[model samples]
Target chain A: MTADRPLRAGAGLKPEHHRHILESRPDIGWFEVHAENYMGAGGPPHFFLERARALYPISLHGVGLSIGSAGGMTPGHLARLKKVADRYDPFVVSEHLAWSTHEGVFLNDLLPLPYTEATLALVSRHVEEAQTVLGRPILIENPSTYLRFEGEEMAETDFLRALARRSGCGLLLDLNNVVVSAVNRSFDPLTYLDTFPVEHVGEVHLAGHAVLGDIEAPLLVDTHDRPVSPEVWGLYHRLITRLGPLPTLVEWDSNVPAWPILEAEVARADSVLRAAGEGRARAA
Target chain B: MLPLDATQQTFAHALLRPELQVPVAVAEMVGPTRERRFAVHRNNVKASLVATLAAKFPVIQRLVGEDFFEATALVFVERHPPRSPVLAEYGAAFPSFLGTFEPAVDLPYLVDVARLEWARHEAFHAADAASSSIGSLAALADDDLESVRLTLHPAATVVASAWPIVSIWTTNTLDAEVRRIGPDTPGEIALITRPDEEVFVHLLPQDADRLIAALADGAPLGEAAASVPDGFDLSTGLALLFSAGAVSGLLEGMSE
Candidate 1:
């Protein structure tokens, strides 16, 4: 179960806990950080992150590239992303399946895109361009969406599968997003996961999400402020069974607690990976 | 079956416009009354992005307070959603946006505050460089100081503003003494640098104008001092600069 498939279990590092994380250097496999947070050169963030980089495999997760927009990718954005990737040398890089910009102004949100032939071509090229600049493949994560485009020609799974197949990039399967999007969109979460092309998955993200209480609404929000929901955790366990111990992250970005609270979350993952070795997840 | 191009547009439109009752086939599995679930995704996208902007421009949020800031933030979001997924680089043009905003017109100084914040943000992430030693700088004779080109750290930022933005920003900032907060006077220049994680800002009217002019022309230490006269204490400034490691090196003055 642990055959060195690039596994890491970590929480998103916050400014409040930077010193604590670095000082403790807990037994976690790796730590994930937002690429934008490290865009600056001389600061405590950089200082600590660099020091920690010596010990942990860092992952750069981007939240702003509007890859889905028909308007095309920004050269400046790609150049900046490349520079940070070069500077940090993060072991893995990932971004949402959603789009965030249009005509230069950024909404700073992961907005949905119509999954069409044109979009497929646009997003695929963006991914290809990113890879070309980086000289390596990045993991394009499936997004948690609130609304569906009325005219989508391809299924979300098909679009992602096609993107991975064509661009040669890996997938960062966010199970909570899968569950959130599935429940919100009224698709079977298992069917979605089962139909998902798990072969290309390089990492998995397990984060908390709050369900918008509108039965009339078809959206499940990705809040990332609380503990991973039990249902989402169950999905994560299933993911490990299939993907076989992929790098898993537990992200708690808002109202983040002390290091000990986050460490407990990491501990759960450690046991999950440990159990996987014994072929216990299938039984559980 | 929806056309690939048509479906995408409609779907994106439906996703954004929650009021739309159109039951596109892709969401059919969501069954009737499925719009609520879809709203979750919309809420997430909105909430997260808003929070990002808030984090980046806390000073602006503070000036306007939470409610007004959030309302304006929403408008800003719809108009200028981030082009890149990188939140750090998301609000590059926010200062300009704040300038043209009608609601913010009464607070003319708001835009400049954004500019200063952006400058601090920019300086914080700017490339690091080694500072030149004071010993070598001391060797430069009186004649050489005026015409030589002085290398400044990439993180050096000089911002000139009409409002007491420095004080206003100071008062509003988490680091600033809250009771000292007051209005800004015009034509003030603020210097910002991040030799460390904590960004430092200094308000120097005469020194700022002279230094900014001199720095722009790539003036050496002596020349920069000449431009500022008694206004700039070159020795003191140089000491600060050397300690802060603001200089990469000093260039020999060809003009002298």
Candidate 2:
């Protein structure tokens, strides 16, 4: 469902900043939470979420749906997500286009899936199932990949477009993922974005990455532990310019800074969004 | 080309089991450096799972130190990967695993400490319930009290340990003050309840454990007190429950 108000720049909600958010009620456009964290029967997570929900729109960003698993989506996981979505009435619900669970074991990381026609059908069906079960269209995000599988039928963007078309789901375009995957696989981030179906992009994610290995053969890890790098910001600027200011989120999951630092990142994203909105208006 | 199911199963095997060769489908894509690139996923998966355990059991990690905890947690991760995608529910089998672990045998109290941490983790996320106030109980007629079963809040949990787990958990987590535990230290019964948004652990006194334990099991006030030692005071137990917000409701006509 569309938000009551236009979605703007936001940050990932963390327990460390829950009280600060509720007390300060900062000028964040909205907040997002990992749906798995709130899957428990109920305590502080629900407590803070209820308080935050009253003041701001929330997006339930799920990290554990394993939507690309070959075996199919877990009914139990979808049920839990539906429960949380119903309880919080999140403005948007999203999951990664990667699998974390395999053969009854949850690897707990968004493992990449090959973009094959068979895999495409599987993910498309799974996304459709999640949307039907949640009774709201879910947003699927592209994952950062360190390696690609051989014998893939299409590019990652093509797979996402097909999945969106088949499932009628929107996209959560994570710019940092684009930059990381591009650097790791030796491709241009802008080229990947050019092929991306921008019309289906409902939300945009901006986060930081750590450069690992030597400078000669660098690997960009989507660590989300620090401030957004300038390169990702550039890609974000490009994204909003083309896509016209979707709901952008600044995610700092690990080594999270204090409220002011995260607020600053959100502020940075809001400025880009405002600039893009202005540019779009001027052109119109 | 391998089917999608085989490719995923092989990939998962490679990530979790280093002995297995990198899935052939993945190897050919990245050319010669596929193994190292695949190791990134392996490292990320292991590190993320270890971090999840570390967050859930900070006391255990602190007691054992970071390096030891990570090494031990890696073993736990391999043996018991999460069944659900919810990382919060991942370590239900960890405390028991620690109990049987050979390396941690020296620290006999480690298992109980893990249990206490797990209990707190569970209480932290357990369902919220409106606690029964003393005023609510005051309205109950004296004759009906013996047969009325008091329901404990969903977040209420009692962890009984033959070791001084409460003192160990408190001194390790909350305080800088150092406390030593010897063989002669008394065992403890920790009552974990989330009175508000914060979960707190209180050491039960005398027979309060038996009484509260019984009450949690749907024992009425009189019968719960009867299960405790002689000279068990129902008023003291009731006061503790009310103060802790452990009692959620009174089930009328329900008795032990």
Candidate 3:
């Protein structure tokens, strides 16, 4: 198996900047790609990804396994995801701590999972099942949401902590998601950062978001289309300060800009890494 | 014990139903109003699916206009939701759905355009293959030339539409069309393939039926040629197809 760069600070490899990434060979710790996007048999996305893989440590972040669903997991989705993970051999395979598919119909969004013991137990089992199937310790990412469950019995952070403990998996702390969810829910973001079992964190994700509506009841959607917000970056600096350097990816999915702009995001993340010390890969 | 199945079912309901209050039994997340919280997810599911369709059928969206197209897509989502998580392969039957859709019936070419778009999508993601060049067959005996089975490219798609779908597709997607963009023919055959990892479109009616039929039958090159028109130049056809990375499997069939 190929070992990725030991340092952290990464970003989602945008298609728009494929040529620029290839031509300039910008310095980013590593690159993460949504597994579904590269699932196509043969295309520029896969073609360029192959080229980038040789130069960088790759992480395959999945958006679709429907891990938190009540209708059990989709075998087809798992099979497909396994096929990709085998082919790419990503250093880290991660998925959202949310459900998207129900009754065989895919919603295509990360549907929230309640922070109750039952939900936790179900999700933990699913995570372990997924990790065992994928033949690796997959990182489960906490999702950003605008909704709260009425009967949720636990905080999301605690449930995630329990999930990692039970599943023998790791955590991919999306700082922007934390900030977005915290701001949206009117919770203390620092407690989540401070209280989260930092030892379980294996990777980090930094991405741009859309500020929807008013700032008070503002739903900061994890759109991944704009520049990472100052607040979110501030959150990342906080994460680097505490969680220490981890493989962080700049995610820009929609309205993708030119390669240089994306590369700049990479550079910015690299700057954080330098400040945080080159220890993102300091053995999770 | 937390009822895992029941919580998930309730979660699904809460996500899809805009007005449905969170089931009293479900777990609490980090938010005040369950509706406001679920609203983000509702928007996400709808928006992502819509965007996936938009990405797949750019020309169709352009033809129908944004508002009408989005409405059509939302309707499609309600009627025939995606069965797969892979968005690329999600709308395989969307073109067929468009044909039966009442509002889209007026624009008969819309279905064909969708078909062509889907074909392109298939070509983009299909498997890679080392194309068997015409040279590989040049050594074949005269008998094998007509009866031997030929392989089609993994990325190749045979789309037979009654409307000038290929022209319409190219007019919108290919930037810089010298020809006037007008609905012309009732039928067109599009050969979509990704030879150099770049998706390309080829207009092929003369070679479509014989090819699709031969590939479907796995007929040897010689036998497959006999099935085509008498004047069909095997060399020229094979060369055009082979060079374009359309010939995928070309093993000689076991002699019967």
Cα error, residue A232 of model 1, in Å, equals 1.3
Model 1 lDDT per residue over A29-136, tens place: 888888777765566667888888887877888876667766666447777777878887888888777766555555456767677777788889989988898888
Report the CAPRI category for model 3: medium
Highest-TM-score candidate: 2
Model 2, span B107-138: residue lDDT tens: 98888889989999998988888888888788
| Angstrom error at residue A237, model 3 | 1.9
User: Model 3 off-target regions past 4 Å?
Assistant: A1-5, A278-284, B1-4, B10-35, B175-178, B181-186, B205-207, B229-236
Q: In angstroms, how far off is B198's CA in candidate 1?
A: 2.5
Better of 1 and 3 by TM-score: 3
lDDT of 1 at B78: 66
Prediction 2 TM-score vs. true? 0.96
Q: If the candidates were sorted by their DockQ against the true structure, best first, what order would they fall in?
A: 2, 3, 1
User: What would the per-residue lDDT of candidate 1 be over residues B86-143, giving only the tens digit for each residue?
Assistant: 5666677788898888988999888888888888878777777665777877887877
Model 3 agreement with the true structure over A28-55: per-residue lDDT tens digits:
7788889988777776777889999888
For candidate 1, give the lDDT: 0.74
